[model samples]
Target: MGKKGILLVNLGTPDSPEVSDVRRYLDEFLMDERVIDINAFQRTLLVKGIIVPFRSPKTSKLYKEIWDENGSPLLYFSKIQAAMVQEKLGDEYQVELAMRYQNPSIASGLDRLKAGLVESIQVIPLFPQYASASTGSVIQKVMELVGKWQTVPPISFINSFHDNELMIDTFAENAQKYQPESYDQILFSFHGLPERQLKKCDHTGQHCLKKDDCCSTLTDVNKFCYSAQCHDTARLIAKKLNIPAEKYSVCFQSRLGKEPWVQPYTSDVLKALAEKGKKRLLVFCPAFVADCLETLYEVSVEYHEEFRALGGEEVQLVASLNDDPKFIDALVAMVKN
Candidate 1:
């Protein structure tokens, strides 16, 4: 056996908080057919004319707020993860990090791996749960690129690791510092996907959004459903934390556009918790493996203020698995497995 290459992928971020960079990153990301899931002309119009133009400046400002001295947390941590995984794997495996969008792209990562002439490649999209806009997109892009190679080495894509014990344990461990029992309620908030996307993944056609508890239980039919997987991930973490079913809520956040997204929305849940006199809340975003704009700015900063306005005392966001040693070990286990 020869050297095996490992490409760790995460959702991309802008090269900088600058408006132009953000607009460009958004353009590449939203333009993906799997992401927007619309016709070419309509997608182009929406991304360029309306979405990017309107969202870039505002998003750029938010990025500026979350930007660290090292830069985008997602990218920064991803690079560290790649280096760490490489070190753990030793010289037998060459590891590289790439973002599904923007700089340090899949193309560059693949190029480096190809130069090594590795015997095989394992592509790990950092999303814990499978989503068409995320892990699916990464897989699609990788296949499209590697297909053009004359002799593509044996390639494998780890689609979803939502059920990984170490991954779940990592999140649970992060919440331990907050003293889980102290919070009024614990909220497992995964990044939201469109309802249509969830339903589309239901091959049985009978499952997904058809019943109230459709997502609460994972089934063969709903195994690939993003919402179902998210709920299951939450259940595992909650179980580890010894959080009773009634004391925890599984919700989705970062919804975009006017069309219905996966419910119940985290924003709505937060308000409802406040109305119900649940003063303190602890939020866990298991969907994301690393802290990015969604976890940092949207959840910690934005949701904190929103919860405060709703009479909620505190909205504490559990830290993400960003370059944590245990998380790196989890990644190593996944790769070795």
Candidate 2:
């Protein structure tokens, strides 16, 4: 009877777009067993010796391109989202924002809720699709911290909202509003994860389908399968918009390292579309509900240029859900449920 709290979680960003800041952030992010999922020694070497040292400078440069007056897009938008959700939820539920990594950590968010003497807490991870690296890590971290608490409050974790009716409606409505003209091709590009990491959760093969029936069919496993859920979201959104199946393609982007991640890579698909004579393309990045480096820089700018260079024209990148009223309404419905 004290208070009810809501913790809004998102994948974090570096404190600054400098190499040093990026390295530090990567050290914490990649060190997560859920993120890299390797043994300690191997994880340390891979993250520090290889990834942090090399990828940091490059990623920092990319961050610089997207850095705003406020700060990194992820942090800025997350703060806004937290404030908005708090305002919407009103005094009944104390809302706090936490980044899975970096400042305003999940532990701190939980601590704030505890300080408020909250009776129940809803932990909503701001990911449209579930990934062991993203949603799983948030869940693991929250459970780890809450486990050490003397009196744990009732908690509910909203894993993914891929097929939420409101979510689909929001995305469909946005697409309609932005690109009213019929698009020759619709591309749904999601953030990529290594295939090995995905197979790790393929227990019973019922949910996974291991490249066969897994994602193609909807089952309990598809609920947790990042690839499957992303595609399903695209399909559902397309259905809502009455888009033809053949006119759309689902692909993955922002792959790091040499390891094979999800396939039909976005770049390759773009080239293929250009060669296949699909001139006008409309792209969507549903993986990220908000516009970040991946959506803004990688897809909108980079891929837009790529398509043009390859003889395509009018490559329009649809905006992310980012605090859209419908999206906000969806979040409210999700939490209330």
Best by lDDT: 1
Stretches of candidate 1 above 4 Å error? none
- Which one is best on TM-score? 1
lDDT of 2 by residue, 92-166 (tens): 889999989988899999999999999999999999999999999999999999999999889989988888898
Count steric clashes of candidate 2.
1
Residue lDDT tens for model 1, 187-232: 9999988898888898878877788999888878888889889989
What C-alpha lDDT values do all the predictions have?
A: 0.92, 0.86
Steric collisions counted per model:
0, 1
Q: Which residue runs does candidate 2 get wrong by more than 4 Å?
A: 206-213
Candidate 1 CA-lDDT value: 0.92
Question: What root-mean-square deviation over C-alphas does model 2 reach?
Answer: 1.6
Candidate 2 C-alpha error for residue 20, in Å: 1.6
Residue 297 in model 1: shift from native, Å? Answer: 0.7
